[model samples]
Target: MKVKSFKYLLTSISVLILVYHLINMFIFWPEIPERIAIHFTKGEPDNWGLKYFLLVIPLIGLFLWWLIGLLTKHPEKLNYINLTEKNREKQYTMAKEIMILMQNLLFIISIFANESLLRYAAGMENGVFIFLSLFLLAVILISLFFNLIWAATLKE
Candidate 1:
């Protein structure tokens, strides 16, 4: 797919994921315990809070989605170590792509975290939550690493 189209696709998917998370939370709200597990360590719940605290997850996700979208609108404001007149446009495009990719991955992570929290609240163990979280984090870091490298090496 073309670059612009790909970016839009990612943005669309991110929006969809956020919506799904919010709806899921709403649908399952009644089932959550009065005091739910809000934090986890090593796949185990460590911190607990009122079930209403669960709203924070999707709210944060929504805020981040909006913030990232706004930030990408002014790519000129993005910092680039090797930005120059000749390569300025190319670098800006790369920076925006990186931001979009990060946003998408973050949304996915947020959904997973929400699911993990809900499961914990229900007194269930999701053994794979930690592993999946780590894997997604690694993917984000690696993608950023390579995208930055590519942006740095861009020619006029």
Candidate 2:
């Protein structure tokens, strides 16, 4: 399969954004390592500015999955010469498999983001990081678990 045209486009955008953010975090950034100043300044916010820089991949993954779901579930009813319910169902099954995989990966990323690796976003506040991390973790886990279990609900 050609992987669908719209999916290719969305995947390309996702790769681009992911690269940009990774470069911004690892190469172009000037954050003070371990709260230690290596220059004339005291220090930075421990990479506060770049904590959430590389989160675009998950967003793009979501859009691509949605596009795949729509295309597979709603192929042109008259375009195929021998369109059958079996073929349509097969396409929908493939799309659901792919979408669930995407959802699982996204949820895993969210779980990692809830760790200290990207905890500087909310600053050094006492409960800001903990609160937001737990909230996001819960949301991603719940969404992925439920959506995967209820993939049939997406049939149209």
Candidate 3:
């Protein structure tokens, strides 16, 4: 996909996920206990805190979305080991694409985490959350590696 179109798609998905999270928070708020799971070990709650702490995930997601959007607009400011006059534009485009992908994946992760927290608070298991987390992490790492290699090895 073209960078512009891909960026727009990511933005739309992020916004939708954010809105969904907000709605879920509102719907689930009444059912959440005074104290909820804030941390997990072996898929079990290990740390507990006030339900309000759940807001942190969505807030972090918003901040990251904005920061990544800013970075996407100015990829030239990003550090690069292979930057040169011949490859600058291509590298910048690649960087922007990578930033956009990362932002989307991270936003999804944040939403999943928030949902997992809610589920845990309701005494539910999060096996799917754990699996999705691992899968997304692999995707992010693999995409980063290949995209960097492609940019670094660019000709003309």
For all predictions, the C-alpha RMSD in Å is 2.3, 11.3, 1.8
The worst-scoring run of ten residues by lDDT in candidate 1 lies at 122-131
| TM-scores of all predicted structures | 0.84, 0.34, 0.90
Task: Put the candidates in TM-score order, highest first.
Answer: 3, 1, 2
Question: Ten consecutive residues with minimal summed lDDT in candidate 2?
Answer: 32-41
lDDT of 3 by residue, 1-156 (tens): 599899888788878877886887898788889999798787667898999889988888878877887898889889886678988888888898999999888888888888888877766676787678678878999999998788667775
CA lDDT, every model vs. true structure: 0.77, 0.45, 0.83
Off by over 4 Å in 3: none
Write candidate 1's Cα lDDT for 34-131 as tens digits: 99878767756688899887778777877887788777778887778777898887787877887787777777787778767876676667557656
- Which runs in model 1 stand beyond 4 Å of their true positions? 128-130
**Two-way lDDT contest, 1 vs 2, winner:** 1
- lDDT (0-100) at residue 104 of candidate 3? 87
Clashing residue pair totals per candidate (backbone < 3 A): 0, 0, 0
- Sliding window of 10 residues with minimal summed lDDT for model 3: 122-131
lDDT rank order: 3, 1, 2
lDDT winner among the candidates? 3
Better of 2 and 3 by lDDT: 3
Model 2 bad stretches (over 4 Å): 1-3, 27-30, 35-85, 92-156
